[model samples]
Target: MPSVLEIRWIMRPASLLVVVAAACVGEPDSSPWSVADSAGVRVVEIAVEPVALPVYASVGELEFTVGSIDGTDGPAFGDVGEVRSLPGGDVLVTESRSQTVGVYDRSGRTLARMGGRGDGPGEFRFLHVAGVAGDTLWIWDPIPQRLTPLSRSGRVWPVVTFEHELADRPGDLRRLADGGFVARTRFQPLDPLDPKYAESKVWTDSLVLRRLDAEGLEIDTIAIAAAEQLLREIWPSPTGEGDGRPVGAMLPFGTQAHWAIDSIGNSVVVDGTSGQMVLRDVRGSIRTVVRFASPPRPLPEAEVERLRRSRLDDVESSPFRPMVERVFSKELLPTAFPRVGGLLVGESGTIWVAQYATFPEEVTEWTAFAPDGEPLGRLSLPARFQAREFGEAYVLGAHTDEFGVQRVQRYRLERP
Candidate 1:
């Protein structure tokens, strides 16, 4: 395991002014309406209108399959991070653990595996995600705080390093038209003793989103709370405690910021725990868009009673016990936030979002929207392929683990 100390030492400093500038340009607004269940979890319903058309099956919808490639002769991939569609139907996949890059064809064949684990010009120790801008592949290594450009042929370009303090883990990277990029940084409260330790923080706080430049410079930083209020109309309390606590007192615990950036550098930061999505434009106008109704499940009252009697000694045995206790002990239940599985912005300003019926499931349903964020239609993906984007076609990726063996597969989106 990589130590937190090492991660901090490798941190790079980037321009924070860019992020501030970006956040300043957006119009701050709240969601139009909100609804809540008996459990006190707010739910917002987005009015979706479906498009009428004879849906045709996309190319290679079921035409592709997963295959194994030898990593000994090429770059090895440990844990796959983000995968993106290249211009010529190719794909770029990030391997975090191994600190390498995997290039595959549309058919899932490994064309070339490049990049290595090092701090040198063409090397990387950890990378979060990558995006393609024109002919260059931009890889974002959050730990090192740098964005290194690579050629399609697996050659590394000059390194662009930035000086900035990024939270422990960084989010996805999106390519912009002006030859720059925007990425999100997630912040967690550092444990006084162990600064990087993360425990039961998910239920009570919101995360911060910092926009970075192409060189890993900080361009702007936006509180998830402000974004949530403007886009989802849901204002999350910063204090983990609900009543009497000042607003924006405590940051989001566990995982709070979930977002994706489009080709235009616009970002959609979704707070699944809060049922809000912060839509940020290039000019820094922020809109809180809320859609998705909380599920009908009531608070697990019986579980609450059981927890009260459970011994503190028993709780120490399981780390999850405290989280469960916190929720039930406080008369809270598991809330449902609309899962934005994948986001894609087309060349024509069309936005496609893959929605999950449940959390962490491979099967996905997709919705299309115009540039103005109007809903267009919905489509379901095939069982095996995990849907990412839906537009003139669909893009899907899948990871399988059977009998301890792991493999990844990609397929074209098809509509029927």
Candidate 2:
């Protein structure tokens, strides 16, 4: 197996991998990883370094060419759930509240709109933007269990309905360049000890992503990752020495493995347990493993208390006030920050790994990695936006405005 150190040239030009600091020349203070090779499968132990945090002030000033879509003239998005960039500087957005799809140009002007709340053809009850391939865009709704495609003009697609009787809940789904798709699914491992099925083992959850043909047939399962336990049931203790029942309380950030399929159908799987990811081919062979310099930070109990108290008004107003009271007690936080926050495979084959700062910051940071797993420094966005797709020279994502309206925006990413 070729080590990531040896695979750097295949994924990035030599200039991006040039050393800039002493930290990049030799092992920093200590070895950050432990490498082992067995049966040609290399497993490297990942430990985030304890170093000075990367500050936005050090990232220099940012310049953005902004484009936004809000409810002004044509179609104003009610709940902008997802956004994707198309080929011609165009964007597709899904409005969950309005249950509509809108197409916007680079200027963020709503050019075309389609679909509304209905059970009829080309309609959806609850919908989300899936992905765009060529001039066709796919929309998925779990309620209707349909994957419908639409033309660039927002017209109903001329092809057959995509089969979505999923064997697993979709973690992420994106259309592949070959009319196929790449998706990650969540699966629960059967616990032999728990026949009643009241309790769940955290390590039993797994994520599997597969490559599928355009006709909805599975081509290959490319990646499999172990998922962490979250939202476990806490029955009352017989000895009265435990917290109350936590009816599926969600974590602030997920520890489940996240992934993105590159333009050529390659899968980039980020491990939720470590600051690393394995880039693999469609055939499921490991091509390279990427790691970055990051340190793990424990969750601040004070912050947890603050957030819990901040929701007092909302909880008191909910109809299920009694249930809400038991959900987020003072003891509901994990010991450490989530291993990884988000992952994106850029159009240029640069992998973007989100920096999970415990507090709010000015610019969101992504530690970009070459496809061969070489660290290529960080890419900082001007705003705190959750980027969902990357175009040739832009980032497409949803950002909320001051009034709490989720709007889709695109910003140009000037890279070296």
Candidate 3:
């Protein structure tokens, strides 16, 4: 079967990859960290101190908020997609529901609203603030599929269109510190009769990571990792023989992997099994493998069943209910809890890895590592706050209240 792939090139020319030594370049420091070389790759194994680092004394002082129950002053945002701090105390917010970017002042006043629902240069069908590169604001729209650069004042620049080659959808477009872009596209067989899955009841779904220059041109393919291991239940064809329809579902709490690229285009891959983070440099070379003392926690069967039942209840009225039931009939709970829930790279090149929270009431604590793979400390955000960007002196994110009202808020970072 034929597949589609869309590739585009925009801003900046490709530069040379700065090569680091293929062997261990530094000696082990006095900390609980050790340095080693594994197959010519440097490894920094950090034995995180058992005594948990104290959480921040306080989250921070409230700076400003830019959403409300009524749209009188500012946007009564239905869904706030992204929030980033701008120079001189301004905030950039992407209101996805309205398909626009709203620039707000420090006092929660709307400065300017950019873009609306459209396919034109300044408009966006599915708008997201990809990242900020100096004075340029990157807006990503996977619907019409292009990257639009805008000034801090919301002035639109040349748009880079994703020209269709093969049919895979590219999304998660993020800007690297070197002024390039990284995106992810997933591949899985939708047709049961796909040649690769013809004789297999189990199919592997994979993720493709591609690097692009500032102009949206392909730089190099980074890595392809298994996104999911799906089990397919084949429904026979009209003749009741070959080429049956395959209905697939993943096992609950299965081990999965996630990745994030930092400012310098260095990538970190987090494997759910061990939770160890493998860091690769801009040239896609393994620079270090960051390990800590934390181990995977055991998940309780009761909680597992509760979650499984909750999932079933969600799809109870859907046509795929039977498939979901079949997927859950085998008690597919994981042996241990997932180690890393999510990962982020701060604006200052700090790697923030969110340790999986067991309960909804538990505040998620993130372990921070310096750009060089040294453990910095632990940081926590306000409960229910989704952090989208960080600054030298503040955290920029969205917080949804109990009334389901979303607000873009910034809090001052209190330094010791």
Alpha-carbon local distance difference test for all models: 0.50, 0.61, 0.68
| lDDT of candidate 3 over 125-164, digit per residue (tens) | 8776777777788888888788888887778999877653
Scanning candidate 3 in windows of ten residues, the lowest lDDT window is: 3-12
Cα lDDT, model 2, residue 307: 54
Better of 1 and 2 by TM-score: 2
lDDT of 2 by residue, 1-416 (tens): 54333343465544434432334457554544344564565554444542322221123222222233444543455776667667766777777777888787765576788989998778888776667777877887666557788888878974345565556656456776667877667655443335343563233367788777888777777888876544445456557874434334334334667777765677778876566788787688996665544556777877666655655566778644543454455444466666566787766676777766543322277666556554555566656566776544567676666666555666666655
Question: How far does residue 42 in candidate 2 sit from its true spot (Å)?
Answer: 6.0
TM-scores of all models? Answer: 0.61, 0.76, 0.77
What's model 3's overall lDDT? 0.68
Off by over 4 Å in 3: 1-33, 46-58, 116-125, 151-158, 162-169, 177-179, 186-192, 195-203, 229-251, 292-294, 358-363
| Global fold similarity of model 2 (TM-score) | 0.76
Candidate ranking under lDDT, highest first, comes to 3, 2, 1
Each prediction's RMSD over C-alphas, in Å, is 13.9, 6.2, 8.5
